[model samples]
Target: MSSNKLSAVLEKQIHHLCLKDFPCGYGTWRKTKDSTEGAETEDTDDLLDLLSCRHSPWRHDKSWSPQAPALRRLAVLTPERLHTDFIYNYFTTLRIVDKGVSVIDDGLLRFSKLEELVLSDNKITEIPAENLPSTLKILELRANRLSALNSLTNCLPPRLEYLSLGSNSLGSHDDIFHLTGRHWPQLVCLDLSDCEFKDQRALLSALSTLSCLRTLVLEGNPFTLAPSYPGFTVDSVPQLSCLDTSWISAEERQCFRGLAKNSDLIVDRASATVSVGRARGIPDPLMRVEENAPDFPVVNYGYFITYEFLSHQTVNLNFDRESKSDAANVIEDDADLQSNRNCEKESCKQLMVYTEETCHDVTHVSGHSTSKLTWSECMDFSHTHTYIVGDLGGLKRFFNKGLYLTIEEEKVLSWPAASEDVPLAKPSRPVKEKKSRKGEESPIKSGSTKDKSKDKKKKSVPELFQDAPIRRILGSVHIPLHSLVTGGQKVLVLCNVGALQTESEVEATQTLEKDLGKTIKEDKKKDKESKQGGGSSTKQKNTAASKGKVKGGQECKMDVHTDNSVSVQLEPVTVEFNVELEKWQSASEAHQLLLPQHNSLSKQPVLS
Candidate 1:
């Protein structure tokens, strides 16, 4: 379309020039159509077809039209004019990425020796199989506009070993059949990641035919969300050495074997494994020990995170309303429908009352449990807890409530050091001693000493970090569960922990805010004067006011002084963790139950 052509794009991309001699009679071939008769013939050795030639002893001169050696590889950039007559048959690899090429032209046939062709990130809808070189062994059409392989699969290259069609619009279950060994028998590695394939059983059945398929990727597809995924795929195609990004372990293969046989397998609830891998970014409480308590002698501290979430049984109540009420449940028939209703409408306002009551009841009876895990600053804590969800609707509702995480910080403090340096607790004399002196005046003094020793042991037990006297709540964050249930893929979440403020810190923050407000007002006044009169003097005054405001903000950082102590400024902490939801069943039990039912044929009575 544009004046810029593929030749120009190739000139800039080529790294070096290679020259070689052309085969004899390389350009002598010419088509000869008999005019008198209807027959046509091609002349392969004739040279008289040449219109012009230099003088030579021989009638045919070979030097006049020297055949230029063909390029073995070409990578073009932004090829406005893609097709050309000059692309030769010597090419083995050709790459044209993100060039907006929408069609595969016959010009590609010129590269008879082409083995690999990369046409990723294009606007291509269908790849005409005839346009591709039969010698092509690897083809990558990732991130294209292709939706179906009906056109391409009809005549796939017999030698095609690797094919990448990821990030395309190929969503049809019928398209899965095109990937079987019937099309490309030698296809060993296939990438259909980020595609739209949804039927898990159909996909597995189709891939099972590719006995040579060693590596398969189906991530970002709807079918991958099945609890049986990867395992089901592995079971269906045991020849696969790798699935998605993970290598298939022998133990995993052995565990999930035979689960996908006959394409009728359902996952068992108790066997599903939901794993949450290790986390990063969890702040170490010991890092701030020196700042929080500098005078204390050898303080012992430990940190752990606790997460609270609702079980699947509670959320299932929203969907299985028909089981509880004969009348169709009006309050939450559909999440999308309820979301579309306006809160300002009278009908919606009336519904809210019932919704709140239902939610409250659901919350009360819900299996709310808190699990504590030790924080790992150096590595990941790859531990996970499982929750059973019976159906898709229940799974959706479960995620709507999400998970809550709280970081609890504890410290073991020495009493003598705390009494002398920190004003947390005041020393008190024992009234028991006075009572004992009066009640047991005749008792031996040795017994009193022993009682005192037992009392001291009970007062300080450093091993019990959970019930430690000095406890600090670092922060808490909420993670939505909806993401965990989607795509059946593992995901890492990172959240910043905003530390809670103490009484003294809160007071100081309020003071700083007031000072900032005054400075802001002063800056506004200076800005107004500058806007009114655009002069050098006004500009200088504005700059000086801004500088003064900056200094004021710096000075506003004051120490939080309380009645008897100064509070330490808390730092922001960040935490990272991985979460994954798995179904113990061969496939999610919820999905299996949701399958459509068909009416059975009636049987006619027959004489025995």
Candidate 2:
């Protein structure tokens, strides 16, 4: 321990140790107390000394690997931070991972011999180019909130070859140009993976300029999510030696090049590649479009992905509420309403929102789908089938809670994978009695005890991929849609159409509910008469009457009327799909090198 430079304080209280003695391949990875205590180091001020004598990136060539000067490695990953800066010119490699760091002290500028610096898993926002030692060759800044690349202009060291800016908020279209290799002519690898990049064309355009780049990572972006992604990426960027985590295959290159020639042919966007496989029990790191986001579930039928959710309890669109009158106040001018509508769209110009047209191509990786339907807040029940109307009872219960609660969230929506032609297996739908109430009262029986128990046990899910985009789109866009029904079909409706509960809606909801109740009562009368008079003969006539009642959203010319707090009377459109994993993928071995391997002495963290 003394030969390894343990500080006097650490030599005293350190109960657990993971030391990488010099001239060794790997170090100990142990904790004394057990898993509950976690793999955490305390008061890391003494950690700097432990790393001072360790040489990282042990090379085949005595003097070097392109990673760093084949010697003098140091990593101080103590989350308990104390000193702001320290001068250590003798060390060639340094890592300060997850040390609650916010600022890089000027002391690092004095590390004239430093070749690599890792400040990942910190709360840093910007990396001032001025203070970085010009002799440094690599930098890792993952999991930060960095947005500006202009700060790095002309600040990169001349020999810098590897850089990682993954999991940051560099989503704006303008940041593409900042990635060029003009500053570091010797640049070889770049990791922009999981950054919020939606436009592939712009990203590819900027990447092509890096003539020296051999490796590129663009995973977790929406653009690369399509089926033709791998092939197209290999086709467009001929210089890439590696795309994402995999090497550019010669067969994949030939395949996509031929497909690129024909424009009229629909590019079959399926089954091109898969995500890195996850090792069991070793949880994959969480990646998000933005930190702490949420998502709505999109169930993909055989060919359609259905995104279903309900509206706010009180939709305050206030669209048609110019007057609150029994006094017969004339409605506002059409021009005034139109102008206000235009203002709504304009005011949301700055937020990062997804447009319908843009999101249309956003494929849910679970399965291939061609169409989707969205639901809105307000819906009229009079037009729907008797069965769909009954489904609204659950919606009423949900809306009454004044929160987002729906049928889709009852179980874990895991997509393991299945054939494209074969639909994903779904839980069996309980067969309900063939009962109808003329589109008035509830039709569905409460589900099985097992299902309700399972639902109750399912804990709140943590942040996932869909949550990232969902939160982004929901943040910038106003209004809501899609609520619960007996079957798994989603209802599509318009958001802006919901206005304050007007006299029309109040009167309409009341009249519709009464009319529906009468229909149920009348149906019973007909059934009784048919059973008594001519059971078999009148059965066909009764069935016809039930089927022909009414259907709306453009067909029956039925009035649209749903009160703010009334039971739901919405339509259900079925979009069938099978659950499939977007093919779970783990980070590449090369990606693991993005930071210093503190415990691996033989294999120091280095660009491969």
Model 2 C-alpha lDDT versus the unseen true structure: 0.42
Tens digit of per-residue lDDT, candidate 2, span 1-608? 11211122112211112223322113233222443455553333333443343553322221212222222222234222212232244456666565556666564576677888777777777777877888888888888778877777647788888898987877667678777667657888988865666555566667777888889887655444433455556656778889776898776665556433322221222111111111111111121112222222322111112122221111122223563222121111112335533432222121112233221111111111122222222212111111101112233232223222111111122233434543433322211111112244322224566765665444212222222221011111121221211111233322221212223344566776677767667767877877777766578887676556533222323443324343233222211112121211222321232123222332433211
lDDT, candidate 2, at 304: 13
Which ranges of candidate 2 are over 4 A from the true structure? 1-87, 258-608
Could you tell me which 10 consecutive residues in candidate 1 have the lowest summed lDDT? 598-607
Off by over 4 Å in 1: 1-87, 245-253, 267-498, 519-568, 571-578, 583-608
Poorest stretch of ten by lDDT in candidate 2 = 382-391
Given candidate 2, what's the lDDT at residue 100?
56
lDDT of 1 by residue, 139-205 (tens): 9999989999999997778899999999898868668878788887899999998777766777777
